[model samples]
Structures are given as structure tokens and as C-alpha cells.
Target: MRILVTGCAGFIGYHLTLKLIENGHNVMGIDNLNDYYDVRLKLDRLKELGIDSDNALHQNKTVASDSFKGFKFVRMSIEDRENLPQLFDHNHFDVVCNLAAQAGVRYSLENPEAYVDSNIVGFLNILECCKNHNIEHLVYASSSSVYGMNKKIPFNTTDSVDHPISLYAASKKSNELMAHTYSHLYGIRTTGLRFFTVYGPWGRPDMAMFLFTEAILNHKPIKVFNHGKLERDFTYIDDIVQGITQIVENKHTAAYNSDNLYHLYNIGNSKSVKLLDFIEAIEDEIGLKASKEMMPMQPGDVEKTWADVSGLERDYNYRPNTPIKSGVKKFVAWYKTYYGNSNE
Candidate 1:
């Protein structure tokens, strides 16, 4: 299979691209490599895949990996109307996994325009390219943030997602709607995955796992938002990659058919962990106590997120099973190694 993975420098995108390459699929990965968090982290991720990131943005570069024979990477944005379509015109892709979006819920409040460009306009370009290229399947990233302000216990895909609290969530919900429209009209097999709090090696710095770990390591006080009352369904990277790979492959007996082409599912670790308990896992793994400061819940934030992945498991026969402690341990180890201190 020839797979085109957008946002290849992103946390999930980086992992997914590697998995696809290992599965013997020819992969073409692309990203804008924006400085939303740290461009260094994004560049380092690309470096891990054997691509030089020097002057990447300046060149709008396309570099093929020498290490991975089947993987090539382009430095581009999904919203690049001319270039995105040109890329699609030149190469025939069997599937497209659209993970490119301006991420971070809090940041969306600060820069809503970025969300409109990357999440909305960028995704429209992806759908248009897919429609034009006759791509067989399109697997894209949605978010659990779409279940905003809902009091539901387990955030199910079937739950009403019209009331998104944040711009980021709104943009993601819009993507799902757009995908559904394209699928219905153009016969594209579009699947939207509502990812939970995904955290692990090469995770995003804006996410809780990285921030807490960084704060703890530096002996700075970690902010316990919502006064330690919040809860989350934190899914590990490996588990996420596994589930996404299955979805991209459409290998399950109950996978989407021509009649059921437009689909959405919650991909998450089913169990929800309290914020304090989750912090405790990090403390236990890093062998350090975090200096904590209780803080009010930020705006556009939900109290809890719990994913009912029953539908995904029923159809795909797989569920995220990484325990909190184990996942934290792996992340801590990766953090220590990625930075200077491997002894921790």
C-alpha cells in the first residue's frame, strides 16, 4: 500500500508513519513543521526518521529517507492549495491519514485563526485531494474534546457533539462533519478517530504528561488544574498507533464497507484516571515528588473525559490496554534518554 500521512512530525503522525513503514507500506509523510510548541522537537522527530531538518521551512523541502527505503517526507502544509493538490496529482496514494492540524485546546483560545486555517481549511484541501485522487480510504484524527461540556460517563461517538466548548474542538467536530459529507457524496471511505488524552514517547510538550514531567524534573511546582478534581482517559502512543494501523488497513471483518463508508469511533484507554492519581503515577515512575499547586480549571476545559471504546472494540477487536503506571514508566525512560539524563 502507498500511504500518505500528513503532519508526519506530529506525535501521533510520527509514530504512525514509522508503523506504516515497518508494515512494508510505501509512505509519503508531510508537515508544515510549525512552531506551535517547539520546532526543535518537531525537527528532532524528523531527524529520528533520518531526514535533515535544517532550513526545512525555508525550502518547503521534500526529502526521501535513506534509512527507510519506502518512506519519503515533504515539508508542507495541508492548506497549501496549489502544492498539496500537485503532490496528489503526481503520486497515486492508496490511503491518506490526515493528522495535520493546529493542535492544543488552550492555544486555540489564543489563536483561533490558526485553527481556522489548519484545522478547517487544511482539512478541506485533504478531502478535495482525496476526492480528486480516488484514494480508497481516508483515516483522519478527531478529538475527545468534541464531547465538550457533556455529562456523559463514557464519551461515545454516538453522543451529541454539537456543543464544543473550544475552538480546537469545534474545528475537529467540523472535520468529522466535512468528512461525512465527502464520503456520502464522493464515495470516499472516511473514518474519523476521536482520540483521548494521548501521551507517551515523542509526545507533545503542550500535553499534560510532558509538562508535568518537565516541571517535576526541574523541581518546579506542577499545576494541578481543577484543584485535582479532573479526570482523563490517557491513551498510550503504542496503543494508539496499533488501533490507527488497524483502522487504516480496514482489516477487521466489521470494518466499513461501501454502504457504511462514513464512520467515527472513540479510540482511547477505556479507564479514566483521576488527575491526582495520574500525577502520582508520574511521581512514582520518575522517583521524585512533584511540588504541586492547586489551580482553577482553565476556560474551555472539561472536568472529565472517558471514552467508550466499546464500538471500536466490537468492530476492530482491539482496545487500548496500557496501564497508567506502565505507560508513565515508558515515557519517563524515554524522556530521560531523549534529554541528557539517562540515569533517572
Candidate 2:
């Protein structure tokens, strides 16, 4: 199968692209490489996939990987109306894993336009291309944040996600609606995976795991939001990738109703670990205690997020089993190797 993976430089997208390539699929990856976090990390991820960072200039030029014969990469934004269509028309992609989006929930509060440009307008371009090119499957990245302020114990796909607390979550919700429209009109099969707080090696710098690990190792104070009362269903990257792979390979076609070709599922670890316990895991991994700075929860932040992935388990036999302790240990090891603790 030929696959087009957008945001291939992103934490999840990079891992997903590597997995697809390992399974002998011809994969073309694209990422704008915006400096939302450190662009260096994104470049390093591309480097691991055998793409030369020097050649990854953001000019829409496609760069073939040096190591992987079946892999190619391009530095382009999904919102590029002209080039995106040209790429679609030329390549005839079988599947499009649309992982590209302006990601940070808090950052959305500062720069809402970024969400509009990448999440909404960019997704529209993807749907248009999928519609025009007759793509078989369109699997996109949604977020658990969409279940904002809901009193539900475990966030389910069937639950109402109408009240998103953040712009990032709202953008993801909008993507689901747009995808359903495309599925209904053009017969394109669409699936939206609402990812939980995914953390592992090559994780985003803005995320809690990365931030806590870095600060703790440096003997800096770690900010505990909501006075250490938060909980998250922190899903591991490998498990997330496995679930995506199963979804890609599974040919369970949706029902024949015009509006039935679209589906949504939560991809997350079912266990919601407390914030303090998660921090303890990191501390145990790094052999250090963090200076704590307890603070109130920021705006656009939810107190807790617990994914109900039974829908995913029932449909795809997916189960995320990586415990927070083990996951944090792995992340800490990677961090030490990559960023070399000078304090050691």
C-alpha cells in the first residue's frame, strides 16, 4: 500500500511512518516543521527515518530517504492549497493518515489563528484531496481534550463533545464533522482517533512528561498544575502506533448508510494515573526529587482525562498495557542519551 502521512515529523506521525515503512508500505511524509516546539527535535526524528535535515527546507521539495527505500519526505504545510492538490494528483495515495495539526492546548489560547490555519483550513484541504483522489482510507488524529468539562467517568466516542474547553479541542471536533461530511458525500471511509495524553521517547517538549523529566534532571522546580490533583490516561507511543496499524490493516467496512462510513474511537491507556503518581514515576526513573511549585490550573485546561477505549478494543482488539512507571523510565533513558545530563 502507498500511504501519505502528514505531520510526519510530529511525535506520533514519525513513529507511525516508521511502522508503515517497516511493513513494506511505500510512504510519503510531509511536515511544515513549525517552531511550536524545538524544530531541532523534529529534524532529529526525520534524521532517524534517514531523511537529511539539510535537504528538508520548507519549499515543497520531496526528499527521498537515504536508508529506507520505500520512504520519502516533503516539508510542506497541509494548508498549501496548490501543492497539496498537485501532490495528490501525481501520487495517487491509497491511504492518508492526517496527523498534521497545530497541537498545544495552551498555545491555542495565545495563537488561535494557528489552530484555524492548520487544524480547520488544513484539514479541509486534506478532505478535498481525499475526496478528489479516491483515497481508500483517511485516518486522522483527534484529541481526548474534545471531551472537555464532561462529567463522564471515562470519555467515550459516543459521548457528546460539543463543549470543548480549548481551541485545539474545538479544532479537532471540527475535523470530525468535516470528515463525516466528506464520507457522506464522496463515499470516502474516514476514522478519527481521539488520542489521550500520549508520552514516550521522542515525545513533544511541551508535554508534561518531557517538561517534568527535563526540569527534574536539571534540579529545576517542576510546576504542578491544579495543585497536583490532575489525572491523565497517559498512552504510550508504541501502543498508539499498534492500534493505528491494526486500524489501517482491518478492512471492516462501515455500514452502507450514506452517513455511516465515518467512525471515531479513543486511542488511550484505559488507566488514568494521578499527576503526583506520574511525577513519582519520573522521579524514580531519574533518581532525583523535584522542587515542586503548585499552581492553579491554567485556562483551557481540564482537571482530568480518562479515555474509554472499549470501542477501540472491541473493534480492533487494541489494548494499551504500558504502565506509567515503565513508560517514564524509557522516556528518561532516552532523555539522558539525547540531551546528556551535565549534572551527572
Candidate 3:
């Protein structure tokens, strides 16, 4: 299978791309490599994928991997109207895993346009390209944040996600809607996985796990948001990649309401770990106590997030099962090795 994985330089995308490559699929990956977080981390992820950082400088140019022959990467954005279509026409990918988006929920509040461009417009471009290219499957990254202010204990796909608290979440919900429209109209097989709090090796710096680890190591005060009352279903990277691979291979043909072959499911660790416990896990891993600054919940933040992945397990026979302690330990180890005690 020839797979097109957008946001290849991203945390999840990089892991997924490597898994696909190891499974003997030819993968072409693309990312704009924006500095939403540290671009160096993205580059390091690409380096792990066998792409030379020096060779990935120019935009719209394909960079072949030196280590993995089946893998190739490009520096591009999904919002590019001309180049995206051109890439589709040239490659004719069998499947597209759309993971590229403006990621952070709080960041969306400050830079809403970035969310609009990447999550909304960019996702539309992906749908258009997939539609025109006769793609067999389109697997995309959705978010648990779509459950918003709902009082539901374990967020399910069947739950109403009409009220999103953040623009980032709203944009993700919009992606699901857009994918459904395309699937219904064009008979495309689309699956949206509502990811819970994903964390692991090569994780994003903006995420809670990374921030807590960094601050703890450097003796900086870690801000305990929502006064440490929050809970999250922190799904591990390996489990996420496994779920994605399963969904990508298992093409959906069932008529979802007689419109198109479309499905959405929660991909997460079923267990919701409390924020304080999570911090303690990090503390245990790094052998450091965090200086805590308790803070009120910022705008557009949810009190808790828990995913009901029964639907995914029923359909795909897989669920995220990584324990928070183990996940945090792996992340802390990776952080220490990657940064080398540099507080920069």
C-alpha cells in the first residue's frame, strides 16, 4: 500500500509513519514544519524517519530517506491548493492519514487564524485531494476536546459534540463533518479517531507531560491547571499507532446512515488518570519534585476527559492500554536523553 501521511514530522504522524514503513508499505509524508512548538523536535523526528535535516529545507520538494527506502518526506502544508493537488495526482496514494492541524487547544485562543487555515481549510484540501484521487481509505485525527462542556463521564462518539469550547476543538469537529460530507457524497471510506491525551517518546513540547518533565528537571515551577483537579485519559504513542494501523487496514464499507462509508470512534486509554497522580508519575520517573504553582483553569479548558473506546474495540479488536506510570517514565527518559540536561 502506498500511504500519504500528512504531518509526518508531528509526534503521532512520525510514529505512525515508522510503523507503516516497518510493515512494508511505501509511505510519502508531508508537513509544513511550522514552529508551533520547537522545530528542532520535529526535525529530530524526521531524522529518526531517515530524512536528513539539511535535505528538508526547501518547501514543496520531496526528500528521500537514506535509511528506509520505502519512506519519503516533503516539506509542505495541506492548505496549499496547487501543490497538494499536484502531489495527489502524481502519487495516487491508496490511503491518507490526515494528522496535520493546529494542535494545542489553548494556542487556538491566541491564534485562531492558524486553526482556521490548518484544521479547517487544510483539512478541506485533504478531502478534495482524496476525493479526486480515488483514495480507498481516509483516516484522520479527531480530538476528545469535541466533547467540550458535556457532563458525560466517558466521552463517546455517539455523544453530542455540538458545543466545542475551543476553536481547535471546533475545527476538529468541523473536520469530522467535512469528512462525513465527502464520504457521503463521493463514497469515500472515512474514519475519524477521537484521540485522548496522547503522550510518549518524541512527544510535543507544548503538551502537559513534556512541560511537567521539563519544568521539574530544570527546577522551574509547573503550573497546576484547574488547581490540579483535571483528569485525562493519556493514551500512549505505541497504542495510538496500533489503533491507527488497524483502522487503516480495515476499510469500512457499511452504510453509515445510507450516506457514505464513514465511522468515528474514540481511541484512548479507557482509564482516566487524575492530574495530580499524573504529576506524581512524572516526579517518580525523573526523580525530581516539581515546584507547583496552582492556577485556575484557563479559558477553553475542560475539567476532565475520558474516552469510551468500546466502539473502537468492538470494531477493530484493539484499545489503548498503556498505564500512565509507564508512559510517563518512557517520556521522561526520552526527554532526558534528547535534551541532555540543557535548560534551554
Candidate 4:
């Protein structure tokens, strides 16, 4: 399969791209490489994929990977309405995994317009390209944040997401609506994965896994939101990638979802862990205790999140089995390797 992976430099996208290429699929990746987090991390991810850091950001110029044959990358935002269609036509991608978006809930409160531009506008462009080119499948990222204030133990796909509290959550809900419209009207096969708290090695700096690790390593006080009473379904990166891969490759039929053209699934560990317990896991792994700064919940923040991945398990045999203890160990090991040589 020849695939297009948007936001290829991102945490999830980078990992997914490697998995796809490893499975013998030809992949073309694209990212704006926005500085929402450290651009150096993005560059380093690209570097692992054999993309030269200096040349990975030239707009519209595609760079082929030196390490992997049939793997290529471009530095273009999916929101680029003009060139996206051209790229689609030129490449004729069989599947498009749209992971590119302005991610982050708290940031959405500060820059709501960025969410609109990247999540809404950029997604519209993707739908248009798929409809125009008759693309096979469009698998995109959604968030557990959409299940805002639901009071449900396991956040299921059928749960009402009409009351999203944050702009970021709203944007993801909007993406699902947009994809459904396209699927119903134009027969575009689409699947939306509502990801829970995804974390692991090469993870985003803004996420808890990276933040807690960095803070603990440097002996900085880690902010304990909600007075250390929050809970999350911390799905490891490998398990998340596995769910995605299975969905992308699985043969869909009318038996599943809305006539095989539209589907939504929760990709998560299906177990919620307390914030303090998670922090303990990090501390135990790093062998360094973090100074805690207890704080109230920020606006648009939820107390807990758990995923109902039963649908995914039944359909794709997806089982997220990475225990919290083991996952933290892996991330800690990678963090040491990655940040140890700071001046390299």
C-alpha cells in the first residue's frame, strides 16, 4: 500500500510511519514541523527516519529517505489548500492517515483560532482531496477529550460528545462530523480513532509523560493538577500504533460500522490510572523523586478518562497489554539516551 501520513514528524505520526514502512508499505510523510513543542525533537525523529534535519523543512520539496527505500517526506502543512490537492493528485495515495492538527487542550484555550485552522480547515482539505481523487481510506485522529464531562467510566464511541468543553475537543468532534458527511455523500471509507492519553518515548514535550520525566530528572517540582486526583487511560505508544496499524490494514465490511464507509473506535488501554500513581511509576523508573506542586484543575480539564476499546478488540483483535510499570521503564530508558547527550 502506498500511503500518505500527514504530520509525519509528530509523536504519533512518526511512530506510525516507521511501522507502515516496516510492514512493506510505501509511505510519503508531511509535516509543517510547527514549533508548538520543541522543533528539535521533531527534527531528531526525522533524523532517525534518515531525513536530513537541514532539508526536511523546505516547503513543497519532497525529500527521500536515505535509510529506507520507498519512504519519502515533505515539509508541508495539510492546511495548505493550494498544494495539498496537487500533492494528492501527483501521488495518488491509497490511504491517508491524517494525524496533523493543532493538538493540546490547554493551548486551545489560548489559541482557539489555531485549532480552527489546523483541525477544522486542514481536515476539510483532506476530505476534499479524498473525494476528488477517489482515495481508498482516510484514517484520522480524534481525542478522548471529546467525551468531556461525560461521567462515564469507559468512554465509548456511542457516548454523547455534543458538549465538548474545549475548542480542541470541539475541533475533533467537528472532524468526525466532516468525515461522516463525506462518507455518506461521497462513499469515502473513513475511520476515526479516539485516542486516550497516549505517551511513551519520543513523545510530545507538552504531554504528561515528557513533562513529568523532564521535571523529575532535573529535580524541578512537577505540577500535580486537580490536587493529584486525576486519572487517565495512559496508552503506550506501541499499543496505540498497533491499534492504528490493524485498523488501517484490516478489511472492512458492511458488518462493521456504518456500512464500512464510516467507523469510530476508542484506542486505549481501557484502564484508568491515578495521576499520583503514574508519577510514582515515573519516579521509580528514573530513580528520582519529583517535588510535587499541587494545583487546582485548569479550565477545560477533566477529572478522569477511560476508554472502551471493546469494539476495537472485537474487530481488529487489538489488545493494549503494556502495563504502566513496563511502559514507564521504556520511556525512561529512551529519555536517558535522548537527553543525556544534550550538547551532541
Candidate 5:
């Protein structure tokens, strides 16, 4: 299979690309490498796959490197329709794993336009390209945030997702709707994975895990929002990647009543963890007590999130095994090594 993985330099995308390449798939990866966080980390991930960090985006070129057999890196953005069509036509990709998006709930309030441009418009472009070409499967990253403010215990795929509290959540919900439209209208096979709070090594700096780790290491007071009374599924990166890999190859049939060649699943650890317990895990891992600063919950922040991944498990035999303690320990170890913090 030849796969087109957008946001290849990103946290999830980088891991997924490497997995696909390892599984003997021809993979073409693209990312603008925007400075959402540290570009150095993105470059370092690319280096692991043997991509040169020397201004490859400046030339708008695709480099065929031998670090991973049949892996090619292209510096491009999903918003660029002209180049995207050309790339699609040239490669005739068998599958597209769409992971590129402006992905922060709190940041979306400040920069709503970025979410609209990248999540909504850019996704439409992908739908158009997949429709034009004879692509086999299209897997996109949706979010558990889409179940905004719902008073549900475990968020399920069948729950009504019409009420979105944040712009980022709204954009993800819109992507799901748009993908369903593409599938219904053009017979395009699409699957949307609603990811829960994913955390592990090579995590995003904007996420809670990275922020808490950085603040703890820097001897700054870590803000404990909602009086340390929040819960998250906290799915590990490896588990999330495994769910994605299985779904990318498993195509859905167009059933009239229950299915339409379009499906959605919650990929997450079924159990939720409290904020205080999560922090304790980190504290235990780094062997440093964090100075706590109690604060009210920020806008677009949820009090708790639990995912119902029964659909994923039944369909794909998926089970997330990494407990919060083990996952946090792995992340803290990577953080210390990556930042050269001896204390951490």
C-alpha cells in the first residue's frame, strides 16, 4: 500500500509514518513544519526517519531518502490545493491518513481562523482530492472534544455531537460531517477516529503532560486547574498508533441502515484518571514534588473525559494496555533525555 500521511513531522503523524514504513508500505509524508511548538523536535523526528533537516521546504521538493525503505518526505501544507492535487495524481495514494490540523482547544478560542482554515477548509480539499482520485481508504483524526459538555459518562460514537463548546471541537465535528457527506455522495470510504487525551513520548508541548513536565523541571509552580479535580482517558501514543494502523487497512462496507462506508470510533483508554493522580505519577517519575498553584478551569476546558472504545475493540481487536503510571514514566524519561535535565 502507498500511504499519504499529512503532518508527518507532528507527534502522532511521525509515529504513524514510521510504523507504516516498517510494515512495508510506500509512504509519502508532508508537513509545513509550522512552529506550533519546537521545530527542533519535529526535525529530530524526521532525522530518525533519515529526512534531512536542511531547508527541504524552501525548495518545495520531495526527497527520497533511504533511512526507511520506500519512505519519501515532502514539505507541503494541506491548505495548498494546487500542489496537493499534483502530489495525489503523481502518487495515486492507496490511503490518506489526515492528521494535520490546528489542534488546541484553548488556542482555538484565540485563533479561530486557523482552525477554520486548516480543519474545515483543508479537510474539504482532502475530500475533493480523494473523490477525484480512486483512493481506497481515508482515515482522519477527529477528537473526543467533539462531545462537548455532554453529561455522558463514557462518550460513545452514537451520542449526539451537535453541541460543541470550543471552536476546535466544532471543527472536528464538522470534519466528521464532511467526511460522511463525501462517503455518501461519492462512495468514498472514510473513517474518523475520535482520539482521547493522548500522552506519551514525543508529545506536544501544548498538552498538559508536556506543560506540567516543563514547569516541574523549571522549578515553576504548576497550575492545578479545577482544584485538581479533572479526569482524562490519557491514551498512550503507541496504543493510539495501533488503532490507527488497524483502521487504515480495514475498509468498511456500505451498509444501508447502520453504515455507509463511513464510520467513527473512539480510540482511547477506557479508564479515566484524575488530575491529581496523573500529577502524582509524574512526580513519582521525576522524583521531584511540583509546587502547585490552584486555579479555576480555563475556557474550552472540560472537567472530565472518558472514552468508550468498545466499537474499536469489537471491530479491530484493539485494547490500550499502557497504564497512566507506566506511560507517564516513559514520557518523563524522554523529557529528561531530550531536554538534558539531570534532575528530571
Candidate 6:
């Protein structure tokens, strides 16, 4: 299988690309390498896959090798219309994993325009390319945030996701709706994975795990939002990669009432952990006490998130198995080694 993995430099993207490459698939990776956090971190992720600084971001940059058996990476944003079409024209990809997006919910409030460009326009461009090229399957990242403020304990795919609280969440929900439209109109098989609070090695700095770890190691006070009452279904990176790989291989072909192929499911750790407990796991892993700064819930933040992955499990036997203790231990170990500080 020849696959195009967008956001290849990102945390989830990095792991997913590696998994695909290891499975004997030729992967063409793409990322804008934007300074959402540190571009250096993103570069380091790519560097791990044998993509160096010199040839990373050049347009049509293709580094082919035996490093990961079969993998090539390009540094380009999906928002670039011309570049996207050109890349699609050059490579005949059977599947496209659209993991790229403007991700943070709080960040969305600060920069809504970025969401529009990356999550909305960029996603549309990917759909267009996939449609034009007649790609077999299109798997894209959606989010649990799309179920914003819903009183539902376990968010489901059939729930009404019409009231997203943040621009980021709204953009992701819009992606699902838009994907369905494209599938209906152009006969593209599209699947949307609503990821829960994903965290692990090479995780995003904007996410809770990274921030709490960084602050705890530095002896700074970690902010406990919503007065430490928030709960999240923190899905580990390995589990996420496995679930996504299964979904990509098992492309959904069920036709909707409109006679189009579309499917959406929650990919998450079924159990939700309170925010304070999650921090405690990190503290235990790093063998440190975190200074606490209890704070009010920020805007567009949900008090709790739980995923009903029953549908995913029933359909594809997808079950996330990494407990918070184990996941946190792995992340802390990776953080220590990667940053040269065992306690960090």
C-alpha cells in the first residue's frame, strides 16, 4: 500500500507513519512544521525517521531509503493548493491518513483564523485531492472536543454534534460533515476517528501531559483547571496507532442512505480519569511532587470526556489497553531520555 500521511512530523503522525512503514507500506509524509509549539521538536521527530533538517521542508522533497524499509517525507502544508495537487499527481497513494490540523482548543480561541485555514480549508483540499485521484480510503483525525459540553457520559457517533464550544472542535465536526458530503458526491470512502485525550512519548506540548510534566520537573506549579475536577480518557500513543492502523486496513464500505461510504467512531481509552489522578500518575512516574495552582476552567474546556468505543470494539475489536499508570511511566521515561533528565 502506498499511503500519504499528513502531519507526519506530529506526535500521532510520527508514530502512525512509522507503523505504516514498518508494515511494508510506502509512506509519503507531509507536515507544515509550523511553530505551533517548537519546530525543533517536530524536526527531531522527523529526524528519528531519517529525515534531516536540510531536505525536510523543500517542496517535492522526497528522501527514499531503507531506514524504515519504505518511507519518504515532504515538508509542506496541506493548505497549499498547488503543492497538494502536484504531490497527489506525482504519487499514486491508495490511502490517505489526514492527521494534520490546527489542534488546540484554547489556541483556537486565540487564533481562529488558523483553524479555518488548517482544519477547514486544508482538510477540504485533502478531500479534493483524494476524490480527484480516486483514493481507496481516506482516514482523517476528528476529536472528542466535537462533542463539546454534551451531558452525555460516553460520547457516541450518533449523537448530535451541532453545538461545538470552540473553533477547533467546530472545525473538526465540520470536517466530519464535509467528509460525508464528499463521500456522498464523489464516491470516496471516508472514515473519521474521534480521538480522545491522546498523550505519550513525543506528545504535543499544548496537551495536558506534556505541560504538567514540564512544570512538575521544573518545580513550577501545574495549573489544575476546573478546580481539578476535569476528567479525560487519556489514550496512549501506541494504542492510538494500533487502532488507527486497523481502521485504515479495514476501510468502511457501508453505504449511507445517500448511497455513499462513510463511517465515524470514537477511538479512546474507555475509562476516564480525573485530572488530579492523571497528574498524580505523572508525579509517581517522575518521582516528584507537583506544585499545584488550582484554576477556573478556561473557556471552551469540557469538565469531562469519556468515549463509548463499543461501536469500534464491536466492528473492529478495537480496545485501548494502556492504563494511566503504565502510560505515564512510559511517557516519563521517554521524556527523561529525550530531554536528558530522568526526573523531568
lDDT of 4 by residue, 218-257 (tens): 8789999999999999999999999999887876633345
Consecutive 10-residue window with the lowest summed lDDT within model 1 = 250-259
Model 1 stretches with alpha carbons more than 4 Å out? 55-58, 342-344
Model 4 has an lDDT value of: 0.92
State the lDDT at 244 in candidate 1.
90
Best by lDDT: 4
Ranking of models by lDDT: 4, 2, 1, 3, 6, 5
- Residue 10's lDDT within candidate 3 is 97
- Stretches of candidate 5 off by over 4 Å are 251-259
Question: What is the TM-score (0 to 1) of candidate 1?
Answer: 0.97
How many backbone collisions does model 5 have?
Answer: 0
Would you estimate the TM-scores of all the predictions? 0.97, 0.97, 0.96, 0.97, 0.96, 0.96
Model 3 TM-score relative to the real fold? 0.96
lDDT of 6 by residue, 76-122 (tens): 88999999999999999999999999989999989999999999999
Clashes of each: 0, 0, 0, 0, 0, 0
Q: What is the lDDT of residue 234 in candidate 5?
A: 91
Backbone clashes, candidate 1: 0
| Residue 211 displacement (Å), model 2 | 0.4
Q: Against the hidden true structure, what lDDT does model 5 obtain?
A: 0.89
Candidate 2 per-residue C-alpha lDDT over 213-236 given as tens digits, one digit per residue, 9 for 90 to 100:
999989999999999999999999
Q: What is the lDDT of residue 187 in candidate 2?
A: 91
Please give the lDDT score for candidate 2. 0.92
> In model 2, how large is the Cα lDDT of residue 109?
89
lDDT of each prediction vs. the true structure?
A: 0.91, 0.92, 0.90, 0.92, 0.89, 0.89
